[model samples]
Target: MSVTVIRPADRAAWLDARRQDVTASVAAAVLNVHPYTSQYQLWAEKTGRLSPDGEATDAMMRGVYIEPVGVAMLRDQKPEWAVEYHADNAYYRDEKIRIGATPDAFAVDPGREGRGNVQIKSASESAFKDYWIDPDTKQVIPPTWIALQAITEARLTGCDWACVALVVITWRGTLRLYVIDIPLIERHWVAIKTGVAEFWRVVDAGEHPPIDWEKDGSTVLDVYRDSYTDVRDLSDDAALDVIIRRYKEAKELESSGKKLADTLKPQIIFALGNSAAGKTASYDIRASTQIRASYVASESQSRVLRIKPRRDHDVDASRF
Candidate 1:
């Protein structure tokens, strides 16, 4: 499969190129499966409506420094395979669908005509134990978002398979390597293309996707940061009416719960006045103090939604 190779001269070039096409990194966003980026946020960024703050994240920095180590460790662990590392900034794009990928490394099986691509990731010990491995099944599965990224990269690179080359960094200053091979699902590619097509269609038509309330709340707030001194009568919105009612009820419960907890904490502390630890019928409580690092928070204003009642109603929506 012949694809276009883009060797970026600098990070700016790479970012610019990434914005032009649906790269493998943000492919999961198109499918609404990515945890970090929502479809709305991706659209906002791609459409130049929202410009991401030009700051490199800690994970991004870690990957930049640990990627070579990850690929090297993978080579050492898989002795039978030939690992090939390419230019870090080389992006391969398929013109057919305008989908592109920047692979971490490529793996070749020696004495065989088979090749696969590797997606390198640096995971903390806790993250590996909690998320990388299935709690119930005890099977290790990389994040679906990253797995999709690897699959898309493999397909774009003309490879047979894709695998996640994970580098688990422990707090004990020890490292662990796991190369989990991902089986190819042909339908996944089809779904990816379909999702990407829909995204591009909306982009061309200047349409915004419906808000993913769960994942896109922060994105919406960030993209539309300005808050004007305006009030509108949203009483006609039945959905918002119910939502606000639930929110108020929940807030009341939270206030009462906090009061109860605060009252109990003093009683428990008094009971444990003479002792540092106390045991109840089903609970063991201990009193302890730890020093915390203090730092000044950055100055920024976040939008707050406040609902004021226009009229009093005795009707209970929750009961209905």
Candidate 2:
């Protein structure tokens, strides 16, 4: 279904429009596998069980400051493509599913074939280094999670394509900018929007979606952290009894594991002496170190010992 676009002036209006709808930022979470925020966390927030983003991180503040810079750089570098800033967030609604999105900004080209949206991102020096790609080539690769968000915005806006402007802060505090063009894929948007629709349905029903135990376990634990405000003894439920037993066993196993590791750590370190590596028939252990600048110490060096199986070794997997 086509989306309805709204340009609301007030912040409250924009926020109200976003309520109960799947916005671009959490679109990845709806489908799971967002790099940072978990789907369960998003679910909790939407269901009004938890309030998140109460305190913005340092990175968030940095993004706020760098957003204008991104907009300015794009306009200066590409004069033909006029970039217009939205004073308030733009809202889009798919009436069928009640899903919506807001892009960072929109491109104002009088003669363009289809509408275009813009996304601005900022990262720290280390992160930028890890994700850096050559923007000059058509082969420029966007970060997966953020790309999903930008594409979701494009889908809501009925745009054929979108542009992402990435800005990074260097170690010396200088800003670097890269621009990438992303074309919309119908199949991807269909899957994302459909998944989001179902997710919102779960929220409206006051129920949780199917949980990926390994992925959502920590979120579930946090959600129930204060579930029992006061402890009281009661008749035992069979499930609770089994859980208590397992918990005791887990604690014992953890203590044993730590003790064993501690006992062996000194012996291994001492045996290494001045050697950086040790080799066995089936395994190799290496000591690696690095020096880097630190905010508190000015400079620091750290070392770690890593162990791995020999490249050609065929170890028995079932012997654990």
Candidate 2 lDDT over 4-113, as tens digits, reads 88888776677668876777877887777577666677786676654333445787677778888999988887788878786466688887787778777888666667
lDDT of each: 0.72, 0.65
Model 2 poorest 10 in a row by lDDT = 227-236
**How much is the lDDT of residue 298 in candidate 1?**
40
* Alpha carbon lDDT at 163, candidate 1: 88
Tens-digit lDDT string for candidate 1 (98-215)? 7898898988877556898888999999999988999889888898998889888988988987889899999897899988988779999888888988988998998887765555
Model 1 has a clash total of: 0
Off by over 4 Å in 2: 2-16, 108-112, 132-139, 213-218, 228-243, 252-320
Looking at model 2, the pairs that clash are: none
Best of the candidates, lDDT: 1
